[model samples]
Target chain A: MLIIGEKINSTRQRINRALISKDSHYIQQVAVDQVANGAQVLDVNCGINIKNEPELMSWLVRIVQEKVKVSLVIDSPNPDALEAGLKVHQGSAIVNSITAEKNRYEKILPLVKKYQAKVIALTIDEKGMPRTARERFDLAKKLVKVTAEHGIPAKDVYIDSLVHPVSTEPQQVTEFLEALRLIKTLPDVQTICGLSNVSFGLPNRSLLNATFVAMVLCSGLDAAIIDPTDKSIRSAIKAAEALLNRDQYCASYIAAHRESKL
Target chain B: MIDPKQIAENLINGQAPKVKELVEQALKDGLTPGQILKEGLIEGMNVVGTRFKANEFYIPEVLVAARAMHAGMDILKPLLAKSGDKPTVKFMIGTVKGDLHDIGKNLVGMMMEGAGFEVIDVGIDVSPEKFVEAVKEKKPHVVGMSALLTTTMPSIKTSIEALKSAGVRDKTKILIGGAPITENFAQEVGADGYAPDAASAVDKARELLQQR
Candidate 1:
């Protein structure tokens, strides 16, 4: 599975303080740790602190790239910050999101085309988040069509079958999985989600998240934005991969346990 | 005759508008408002609570079902009041100081409301003094606290200490929950009980009420 490390985001107090202090060592260590813990992509966000977003985005990209070889996912609500990160990133990056909203697509797609970056397409529109899998599927179809219109290939699009917390709605997980399954059926369109979303408002969040990860993987999730250093998620993903035969002969699982001294 | 059982079914299915209409129709059918309150809204929410505790239902399900039950309550509240009826228990809840996390608290609040308790939400980042002030003002039967961060978990004890000093500690049962909290921590903080989730929080609150 493709793991996008989510720990570097500034919403986390430590990361936020690190960013404010220009603590490159802390940021770099987090990036290195994520890569060491199996992150293939590092999701970089300046958090809700938007005052110096463009500068912080570039600084984060440069600092993380210095210590790690993984590609970056430029996560920002602002297109300018995303553009800043894309420009500073060493290789082609993944634009961490765009939605089915016309304004968002129009603003972000040109940058994707310019940067030649992979894109995470959220199945949402001006009407806000879709509550059902069918609605999400329809939005996914629209997203693919719109991205294709921008000359981006279907393979380059990662459909985020948005996972609302199951604690808030019992059927949200089922709907999200169903959307993911449907998205997988579309040729070359990959599926991804924020792994912790399933457990929000619930107790023992790690257990819920780990179990949901295994379940979504079975439902055809291609990647996830999550805390790569979380032991429960790490173990769950490795075990699920082995059980699903995605890890050939359990080599990855065995290697992981050996490396972690487990 | 509008069946109260159908009201329960509508609530389970999260049909708020239908539940509202059915509740009004039942009242029009000459049913006692108390009977509608007990057999319809409360019964429906009881099923939701049980399902939630069993993990058969999740947060969104409980929220919607509660809203449906509220719809039934809206029509019944005044009538039940005219008949001198009221939910016997009152719950006061909040996230502890330095903790902005309210989702867990909100869930517990919602579940408490669904289970026919009057819930007073004290909001997030509440200090010990603030909690004491609320206890003094609301005089709630139960005071529930939550904290998602380990950093803020100690505030639960602080709040409890404040309540004790205010002499209202014995007046209300204190319940604690959050990601970093355990039953042992709850006891350590001098809480009456600890709940693992929203559904269990309701059960725990009821148990505390019974003890009181």
Candidate 2:
């Protein structure tokens, strides 16, 4: 039930525009609107194309935290930028990721261990992803065991079960759901899914995606890669939790409704 | 009794090679995906999300972890799909006219899917006429509109106007968002709801649909 806001990343057109033009005002608003609408974490991606990622990450962190009390998810693929952002982080934070690739781990995990920050672990490895649930689960456990050697506990890590575009294989969806159900049982782990990847190349994708999310939670996914900007999907999660008895006494449901009329 | 903290640390330090293997090992050893996800994965992401909200996890990290989680789901999705399950509800969404921004729209779309709702994304640059047409054809319980520009923000209003004109507005709930959008704007434009971020979007969508 943790909502990590995905806006404010430089990959988006507007943020990219803001980065290109050095438009601090527009960048600040991305922080503003997302926070106002109830984003607990503002994700800051300075874009792979930008030159000054560290400085931008620092600046974005300062601006967003200034506006709201929410934590920041400083995301980037560059190890240098991720570390640079980590250097300036004022409070508790999550390191966006660590993968099974040796280079990825060699580059990323030490920082996470150094900072004791929570990390997102992808099930993929050096070559690519496994084709079956058994292989996937094996990799996830390997990550847990390997990271434990670094003194980071398994509980501190989150496993991202990747969601591939459905356009490639219809049966993959079925495979995905099965893995999701099984993933919930991993020792001291949380399962997060990048929800958008499923509909890539399909028509009327949003609907297909929303429907898919509702179906997956039966496996008890912990977090999602989602826009804090979309209400329909948010509404769906809240409603499902309430109806499914995940939210005791419907407290979250009522609060969600009330907070918005604001 | 679950220690989300320890699990999170193991993940951060690369104790696990991949989240999927960790999950399966947990299952074989009698741990549940729900337990692992909640105590470890979810708990760890909570740490990540909290840091994200606090400006601690930078863009690369979020993207990386998001990629990681996407990787994990490649293992998890099929299992969940056939777990003798059913979708909680159904909704349709699309980007409003004159706007090509879709990352946000797409994220929300996926969250809904994760939450077990039927979501239809009509793609970017969707028009009001298209909105009405889809509503009629799909007969969805809810409709979502996205606009990233103040200039294009009007398309959200216009789409609703189209829905109202088509007399199908009342039959479906409408939600709105984008950079220039706000709660007041959502109301003014006649949307029943608005989500500021993708996580809450799923929460909102769930609440609204359940109300009906």
Candidate 3:
């Protein structure tokens, strides 16, 4: 599975403070650490100060890329910030999201096409979040068709079923897993989710999150926006992959074990 | 024989039908609508809000409890209005322009309703002009703005500015919040109050009104 490091997002208090203070060293260390811990892509979000987002996004894109070799996921709701980050981002970056909301889709798709970036398409529209597997699948299908029409291929489109808090909506996990299975039936599009949202408002969140990750992997999740530095979650991913026979002869699991021992 | 405490307990447990039934029973047994509202619905929702803040109750629980509160409110609303016991404070809420997110805003609206405020949700992607127009028409005691994205956060200030230019800024207390909003940001934007979460939004709304 592709692991998108979610640590550099400015929503967290520390990251928000760092971004506001222009702490380049703190931001770079986080990027380097995630990549070292097995993140192949880092999601950089500098949405702390709206007025400074464009400047901060580009600055973050530049500084983080200077320290790491991985591709990036420019996560922002602001088209300006996305463009600013894309302008400076070196590899083929992944745009964090494009939703089916008419205005958002119109505003973000051209940027994705212009930048030739892979895109994460969320199952949301003007009506807000989908409440069932059918709703999610329908939105996913629409996103795939729309992005394809916009000249972005299905393979480059990542469909996020949008995990709701299972604590709030107990059936949400079942619905999410079902949606993932249904989404895989679509032609060549990838499936991803933010792991922590499933465990929101629940105690022993890490336990719920790790277990949910295993469940989604079993349901054919291709990628996850997650804290790559979470040891338990990493172990869960490796173990699940090995158990599901996605790992060849459990080689990746053995390598992980050896590295941990070292 | 209807006990208001029983009504409160049923509301807390999210038994909407039971809460309504008990409120009806309380009224039929000579309890005032005000008494049932205070000792039953509001009393129950206060526990819900406190538990939510303490991490004991999550969104599902709070939402369910709010539904129960609404069920009881339906029984008392007409009677209260007839008796000139309408909810004292009116709150108008919306997600600022360019932001379509409303989960947080909805939560605050529900909590405020539970706290006995008459809430008018102007919905998401509300422009500054819409805010100014609503402030003029609704004449709400407090105006709350929400923005989940850092990109949309500036719209809060813009809306406040619009209200100021329209000369309606002082007519209502402005409260700002969302994932990206901070107390400092609220102050910088010249808002009257800021709350980090939905439960506190209720307290802040009450506190802001009291200061008026």
What are the per-residue Cα lDDT tens digits for candidate 1 across B1-212?
A: 99999999999999999999999899899999888877888788888888888878767677888789888888888887788787778899999986666678887887787777889999988999999999999999999999875456778999999999999899999999987677877887799999988889988998999997
Candidate 2 lDDT (Cα, 0 to 1): 0.70
Worst 10-residue stretch by lDDT in candidate 2 chain A? A164-173
List, residue by residue over B110-168, the lDDT tens digit for candidate 2.
55554446678898888889889999998888787888654467678889988988999
Calculate the i-RMS of every candidate, to one decimal place: 8.4, 15.9, 2.6
What CA RMSD would you report for each candidate? Answer: 10.9, 21.9, 2.6
Model 3 vs. true fold: TM: 0.91
Across residues A74-108, which tens digit of lDDT does each residue of candidate 2 receive? Answer: 68756877788777776777777777877778788
Docking class of 1: incorrect
| DockQ class, candidate 2 | incorrect
Over the stretch A1-262, how does candidate 1's per-residue lDDT look in tens digits?
A: 8999998887576888899999999999999999988899999988445568889899999999989998999997678998999998988899978999898889999999999999999887876678899999999999999999999999999999778777766777888888888888899998889988788756789999999999989998888999988989989999999999999999999998888822
- Give DockQ per model, in order: 0.15, 0.01, 0.46
Q: For candidate 1 chain A, which ten residues in a row score worst on lDDT?
A: A45-54
Ordered list by lDDT, greatest first: 3, 1, 2
